[model samples]
Target: MENLKKTLIKAARKAHQVFDELKDRPSSDPIKIESYTGYASQDRMFLKGRVLEDDNIMVTKSYEELKRIFYSFKRFETDEIPGVKVLLYLDDHEFQVYTDEEGFYTLDIATPDSINVKPGEWIRGYAELPDIVGDDGPVRGTIKLRVPDSEASYGVISDIDDTILQTHVTSLFQLKMMFVTLFKEASQRLAMEGMVELYQEMSTTPVGGKNPFFYVSNSPWNIYPMLVEFLKLNELPSGPVLLRDFGFGMLHQNEGYRGHKIETISHIFRAYPDMQFILFGDSGSKDADVYLNLALEFPDQIKTIYIRHLKDTKNARRVANLINQKGEVDAIIIDSTREIAADAREKGYVSEKFVLTEVEADE
Candidate 1:
């Protein structure tokens, strides 16, 4: 493992040698909108997207899609385009915002309450940046806004690593994670067994209720587009993905990792104070400790905690102990998503008949 780490570090240094020379260079090309998914809570909308150089080549269909996956890796970040104008248009209203120093912008705007934005539905909207232009004209793209059902029993806040996807966060030195991220395409990575089905069932209500799902990860925003593609490929319920910013400076920083995740999850809780949340994470990293702290802080807001047990028995016991200390919140440590699915069904969180039907169809 130490040798592998050294090799990976050498390769990264080599890549950075080239990256360093180009990092300070500026591009004259117009900026384009690279919008991530957005989610709404109550009367406010939380919007996040990046302003990047308009250098992507258009792709369509099967073969082209494969090429597009490669193009995603080569995407250029226009960090120099900070303070550019970005407009979010919903219905007849337009909310104007500016990109931050990292060329990433987030808009938290007050929107008039409306019943038209149904739960589990993607609200269609256009993001316009008139200064940014492509070959044909001004840079603009369709942005989808996801809203949770008003009658949903509870909302879901999940971690990306190990819970839904096979990221070796718990593996020795995270070698498998490095291997997969370096060589595999989003479609090539495998989803956790029965996770997609279980999530779908949990998100559905008997009266066609649609709960909201949010994915929080330690990964930086650089891979947001690829993660979105992976979620779409696996047919997982889509919601806003909150990711951190990574640059030369972030590499040496560890103080903010836990705090950033806590802040993001707190914002969601504040956004929808009346809505209960189901927390899904793994025992790999600080998830167990983080979730435990969160449940203690917002005991009423959290309905249950689901922690996927990794192979590390010591870590598992530590997490189980932490969960056991929190008597107010119902927490469980399981080796698979199927166990949670069965528990959820038995506890009236989902319909078993619907899950069986969907699984049969997929088979």
Candidate 2:
């Protein structure tokens, strides 16, 4: 009886320890969908709100639950609305959901039973409501949830002012200030040229049909919405967006960007083992340095590096040399969209068969 009592006590203590560990584990809460309404100046038609999930996970207060619930809200004018498509990504596993109604849809994600997620994980959700009759045909958005024990394949670390949009940050000291003051006027005066073509090219499937366009930007968090709108307007392929927070003490103390882009990229590479990346940036910033370091660190995972030339020819050449030293760049071509496209074609980067074609400005 004494031996049996001792065994029972040991088992009870072990069970309590396990329960305490689970209770203390971190978790994420369901993200609420926000709606909006706007107009596309090109079409001059009313654009209805199509709420989408952001690419990052929405973290909840409870950290140990190991489960996440997400709601997708979509609305259209008529019953014949195109079906809503939802993409849920947890680590390397991706789940797709389709909704037939013009209302709300929900999903429940539970952690894998085998693993006890320690610090929790990030789960991202994306939604698209394309082709609504009597309204603009396209509506797109995304949502995110954080779960326990899950891991992301890759993290997007990006530069904001130029790579994602048309902002010339190097020339303008306070670029975001300039944007806030001039974006509306600029949107009215200047039409986006070649944007659609560039987007189409980037959105197409790669050689092995791998999805490789993740975003990492130097821009601060305050202007994420503006950048997102700009990308959507251009019909560009969207991915995870990482923004720096200027308000953080690091920026004030370091006199440099708050987020160490190279370090972030390195961390992301470690987190997502199966993920490979195509690095995109402009010559206006330290993207060359950051990407060069990344290539050196993760030579196998980095497929190609595309840098937009926003600097003088001499400066651009110097940056090119840095990338060349990295040894992983498949090719480095400097020019606008047309010239880059031509070079890409010549190198068999654009297509399997090299076909010489004229690069025209896309409308």
Candidate 3:
């Protein structure tokens, strides 16, 4: 009898240990959808977004609430909820994919010939999370394809930092300044003077048509929504904003941080093989170096290179020498977007009417 009692006591202790360990385990989070802009082509469509199980997500409707808006960045930069089922609805058809380890899902789907889309036309796409998600329906997003407009003379591709927005990325107090600017309301953030005018001129076309503007930034995808709001507030030309995934760790840089920009640009080049591109970036970072290499690599596709001088005269000189050696491409360094507007007019990259109207509006 004593032996049986001892066995019962042992079992009770084991049960208690198991219960204690189970109580400490973290609960699994339900899937939440975070969608981004997608691009489509003549016969193919590419869509991308991240699936997260974040419970603390709070979106600020107004830019006035700086503290609430700042916390939204934290909610997105956290770990991706992997292995979740995601359904993408393109028009009437549907495509299914599972989130990868990083909680990112990309769909490269071939479109039926019946679904005819034109250049600059925005296609509606819905990212449907599993029923386990709390949302009522699939998250909606827009798809922009590389439909070459015969009216579009060339396409404009630009960097977001000091080139268009004052990021101070190369400043000695970069991190501190970034923290201050990032937390501020988007309306409070300052846009580079005369940049919108220049970009608008570049996006101009003959016969009341306009060229496409593509923004390729090194900023992480976590802050993408905020960036969109800022662009709208500033009245900048809208286009595909391609960004990188910084992943779970705040300090961890993605392995492709150095080459991701070029890789993305290469994809754009391939998508629209016949379209010529004008590149823009700030000289403060590796923009000059990367763009120089890109000009050489895609000599026929690159039309002109514009580098915003961020006190990096030395790098600018190197870029000019290299481009001059090539003899096929034009590269210039400027202090403001107004300089680009002047250059664009002289080079016939944009119509004189567009430049004049932009200047008048600013005045």
Highest TM-score scorer: 1
Q: Candidate 1, overall lDDT?
A: 0.75
List per-prediction Cα lDDT, in the order shown.
Answer: 0.75, 0.46, 0.70
Better of 1 and 3 by TM-score: 1
Ten contiguous residues minimizing lDDT sum, candidate 2? 71-80
Note the residue pairs that clash in candidate 3: 40-145
Score residue 184 of candidate 3 by CA lDDT: 56
| Cα lDDT of model 1 by residue, 194-267, tens digit | 88888887887788878889999888777776678889889998888888876533333454565667878987
- What number of backbone clashes does candidate 2 have, counting pairs of residues 3 or more apart or in separate chains? 22
What stretches of model 3 exceed 4 Å from their correct place? 1-31, 54-79, 109-112, 131-150, 248-258, 313-326, 353-363
lDDT of 2 by residue, 62-128 (tens): 2232332221011111112124554443335555555422223334333444323332323343444
Global Cα RMSD, each model? 6.0, 18.0, 10.4
Q: Rank the candidates by lDDT, best first.
A: 1, 3, 2
Pick by lDDT: 1 or 2, better one? 1
Q: Alpha-carbon error at 308 in model 1, in Å?
A: 0.5
- The TM-score of candidate 1 is 0.81
